[model samples]
Target chain A: MKQLRHFFDLVARTLFVLSSTPFRMKEFSRQLYFVANGSLPIVLFCVGFAAIVTILEASFHMKLVIQNDSMVPGFAALLILRELGPVVTALLLTSRVGAGFTAEVGLMKTTEQIDALRMLGIDPVQYLVVPRLIATIVGTFLLALLASMTCLLGAMFVTDIHLGYSPAMFLSSMRVFVDFQDLLLAGLKGAVFGAVIPLVSCHFGFLCEEGAEGVGKATTQSVVVSSVSIIVLDFILSYVFSYV
Target chain B: MIEYRGLVKRFGAKTILNGLNLRIEEGEIVFVLGTSGTGKSVLLKNTVGLFRPDAGEIWIQGREVSKLSEHDYLEVRKVCGMVFQHPALFDSMTVYENVAFGLRRFEELSESEIADRVKESLARVHLKGIEDKKPPQISYGMQKRVSLARTVALNPRILLFDEPTTGLDPVTTRAVNHLIFELSRKMKTTSIVVSHDMECALEIADRIVLLDKGSIVTQGTPSEIKKSEIPLVRGFLEEVLA
Candidate 1:
């Protein structure tokens, strides 16, 4: 119960900090650009690869089970949007952006930038943690949405090239099974993953003990927590959405 | 003025501060001098409630801060500003933003007013044109100045400096010492400085207190400290003189 209270207290403080002027829309937009701009090429590349693999695997399994290429497109779309999209996008960010955030904040703590904030009567958690939390949410939402769309496009290309099914059939079949809830669930999961990933990662970063060794510890912890969280939360969200 | 009575701090098996008592008058610039690991920084941390003492009371401007809640401590901490040994400039912020951080937080100044004060603070530190530069791009001396600028920008009534001149060139050390003297006079801000650098301490400290094993060993003016007969004092002087 005490721990639960602390959790709510932390959430309240976090919200208050983010609502402060530093994390206002202008700053949020600036940090979002920093978080997302450099990774567009790599994100697109990874999503493209995941889409191709989903199509190839779907075609192989569908052939074994039903002996038809007509159902393969929808299967690819469902898999990409429902599962592969959020998970793969999360993995990419955990490696790329999450580790970077850990390293940056960890280095700052070790070097005393965090101490400076405390001395200035600014809560390091508020000034540092909140802006970062906001950035992660925004960055992750956009990344996951883009990944889902590109993965769908990649699947279409795969159908045209390898499976010889036209784009129209792929679209119609995808429309039949996928709904607003599925996309909403995927995006919502991404947002949760986004918020959780950086919060966990920065928590490790802020808790760093000393110098270079501490920074390394934070980076390792960030990756581990974020990756494990993505997997566990992915399962839970999938199960809950199944009921919905 | 700040006062600590029967202050005791311990870290697990280690006893850092044991039954210590000390005081500083309203506008005095006092240097708490000690070797490494002698709890110099720990003493500074305790004054502002950064670390809670195991026992005893910390009085800041007649308020017993040892018993203040974290929320109330924040109010007390507003009266004090600290500049760390190493420049702790926020890397995510530009020099201008770093100096303006505190003003933005607790002040109701307009954007243009905030901008003017930030510029004034930077100019006071002689870091005028470098406002747009990141901390990493600057020299260590300049970074220290920027840290000082940030602290002074907050306009605290008390300034806590933890080893303000630990690693700097002689010129930078002199500049920092002069700035300390100037700010203490100009703002009438009480300064609690901790340093092992005898030269820098002697240059800036109106009163010098020496600490050993988490206890005050000796304290006096620079002239008196120079004439002290205590073995620890003589030994320290000998080592630094060598």
Candidate 2:
């Protein structure tokens, strides 16, 4: 019951902060840089490899069942857009950006910087959580799009070299199989994962106990909780969005 | 003005403050002196609504602060500032930005005016210049001074100092004490300083309230506290002054 109450409280606060615009644009921009730009290389690398592995595995099975590789692009498109793109990106961000937010906020709490902000008549939520939340939501959405594109490119490369399918054939197959709804669902999932990462991270960070050990624990919990939340949310969202 | 009536605070099975009552008049400097873990810092935090009492009433400026909501408490907090023991300045920001933080948040001033106020506050703490340096780049004493400047920049009606001179050398401790004295006298702001430093309490406090095991052992003028008959107060003063 207490956890449910806290979850709802965090949701309400996040909405309130999102609507109240123009409070701290500078901080928001800085956080965007940290979240999006700082994680670009890793996102690129991970999505590329995930795309290669998925295509290779799918083609291997297709050869056994149908003795053809023409269906590989469609299969890859379905997996990447609906599942791998957003979930993989979210997991990466949960480890990188989410852990960073938790550790930073935990340090500030231990050092009494958050208390100092309250003493100065500044709302710590407005000054700290809002910017980070906004950045995570927007950054994760964009990174998911980037990941999807990178995966397609990687799948094209793999099919061209190993499966005797040209890059044009792969592109044509993806265009035929992947629709606007798939892309929309992927984007929506990205935004949900984005919101969950910061919410879980900041919640643990704010509730962190004192001392260095507390910070370490909070960081670990943030990553673990965020990853689990992303996976669980992915399942739920996929189930719900499937009907549409 | 501040008033605490029958305040009670506990952590788990251990009580930190018990039925503590005290009154601080406006423009007066009161020092809370006690050994470590006697709830000296806890008492100061309670006054600012940082730590709410389990059962009690705290009145500040004729308002029942304990009943104020989070939003309402922010209004009350604006009239008060707290200088922490370790100088909790934002590590990422420069000295000027730290002092200007409160002013920028609460007040609408031109850039030049903000700069002037930041400069003035720093000067009041004898920290003129070095505004571009970050907190980590400065010495510990200077960091504390920057923290003081940050709080004073808001021009709060009441100031709370929590063990402000705890971990400083004698020279820096004396400087911090002197700065507190000058700020209280010059600004006519009601000040409550929590510390275990006898010399600091004796030097700047108009009245000293000594705490022993979650209760006030004695409360009197500095001269009267010097002549206190309580064994805890006497022993603490002897140990600190010795």
RMSD to the hidden true structure, all candidates: 3.2, 2.2
Candidate 1 lDDT score at position A87: 80
Among all windows of 10 consecutive residues in model 1 chain A, the one with the lowest summed lDDT is A1-10
lDDT of 2 by residue, B122-230 (tens): 9999988689999999999999999999999989999999999878999999999999999989999999999888877887799999887788989999889888888
Q: Count backbone clashes in candidate 1.
A: 0
TM-score of chain A of each: 0.90, 0.95
lDDT of 1 by residue, A63-87 (tens): 8888976888887888888887778
Please state the error at residue A209 of candidate 2 in Å. 1.8
Model 1 achieves a DockQ score of 0.61
- What's the C-alpha lDDT at position B218 in model 2? 91
TM-score of every candidate: 0.89, 0.93
Q: Which stretches in model 1 have alpha-carbon errors above 4 Å?
A: A1-12, A15-23, A61-70, B106-132, B227-231
Off by over 4 Å in 2: A1-4, A20-23, A61-70, B11-14, B229-231
Identify the leading candidate in terms of lDDT. Answer: 2
Clashes of 2: 0
